[model samples]
Target: MLSKRIISCLDVRNGKLAKSVKFVDTIDIGDPVVQAKKYYEEGLDELVFYDITASSDKRDIMLDVVSSVAEQVFIPFSVGGGLRTVEDCSRVLLAGAEKINVNSAAVRRPELIREAADAFGSQAVVLSMDVLRVEPRPGLENGYEIVIEGGRRRMGIDAIEWAKRGEELGAGELVINSIDADGTKEGYELTLTRMISEAVSIPIIASGGGGTPEHLYDVLTEGKADAALVASMLHYDEYSIDEIKDYLIGRGLKIRKA
Candidate 1:
């Protein structure tokens, strides 16, 4: 099996590392730059950074902070939030992020995804979807829908169809953030994740509700995700990257060793 990636996520709000439960009740945590460096040194496989409020606030990401965090880690770094156009993505890549994720902007104009993929190879373009479980509809036969503006706006787009559309539009990967699971640390929405992962040909990174090593394993194996985007458990230092990796290894999962 290809080694599963253990990615640490740093959600920022107004230039400070923050945490949120169900996409609300956000709280400042610490300096993201410090945490980025710390996690890289500890052998993290990858790191994802998000200007969580940028989409809601309708502003660009803080390049200074993105640059600062990029400077701290040499691993694969991805950034998102307030990134709308190809130029915005270019600025971020130039600022040092390896990948640029588009959410609200891409949904507003899907051409942006194709444009970005054309400008900077598809490998650099990530489609991040915030999903919420809802009643089934014609297009959303799965009962899962897409939400934007940090879970404040319901897009009415079906998650499965959206994933396929993102791949067709040249998105290299998909990060599915379950609104109900966000910050819950209970466990991931495995059925939601597995459905999307199987629906798309690209890799799927399961986000939200990651509380323990077992949760990570479940999402990667049974959930059929290619990676696990972790925040709370790591943000509070509840478990070290190495500790998590060791547990996955013991459970017989092929993981990129920390």
Candidate 2:
């Protein structure tokens, strides 16, 4: 079995890294370039940098910051936020992102997914879904809607169906971020994560609410996730990357131990 990956996320806003609960109540953390360097030195499997407000604010991702961090980190890095056009995708790729994550833009123009995959191959594109469970609309049976626009807009789309569609559209992987569970550290949304994992052949990275090493264990072992994306725990110094890897290794999960 391939070793499960421990990825540290850097949420950048105005060139500064930040974190929030359920995608709101934002607090500044620090410079993303510094944080990226720190995680790389800590021996993390990969790094994810999100221009957290870019999509919602309708602006381009910070290329200067992206370039700076990309220059510093040796590990594979994935970048997201406000990437809407083929040119937008190319700019970031040239700036040094190994993979480009598209969220609201993809939903708005799924052709962008196909275009990106055609231009850069599916392996270079990651479709990120910021999902929240909402009451089924009138005339619909019991079901939840997939919210978008950084979790602020309701799209009336089913989350499971969306994942399937993303796979069909040639998305190499999916990052399912649970808005309800984000930053709570309670745990990942296992049911949703498992459902998406089983529904799609591509790897799924489970995000949100990972507060403990056990949370990571449960998500990989039971939730059926390919990897776990952690932010607050690692950012606050609650746990080190080596410590998390050791715990997963002790639990019989495959992980690279340094």
Model 1 segments more than 4 A misplaced: 53-61
**Clash pairs, model 2 backbone:** none
- Candidate 2 Cα misplacement greater than 4 A, ranges: 53-61, 136-142
- Model 2 C-alpha lDDT per residue in residues 169-215, reported as the tens digit of each score: 88999999998898789999898899889989999999999999999
For model 1, which pairs clash? none
lDDT of 1 by residue, 67-126 (tens): 887777789989988888898899889999999999999988999999999999999999
Give RMSD to native, each candidate: 1.8, 2.2
Listed per model in order, the count of residue pairs whose N, CA or C atoms clash below 3 Å is 0, 0
Give the number of the best model, judged by TM-score.
1
| Residue-level error in angstroms, candidate 1, position 57 | 10
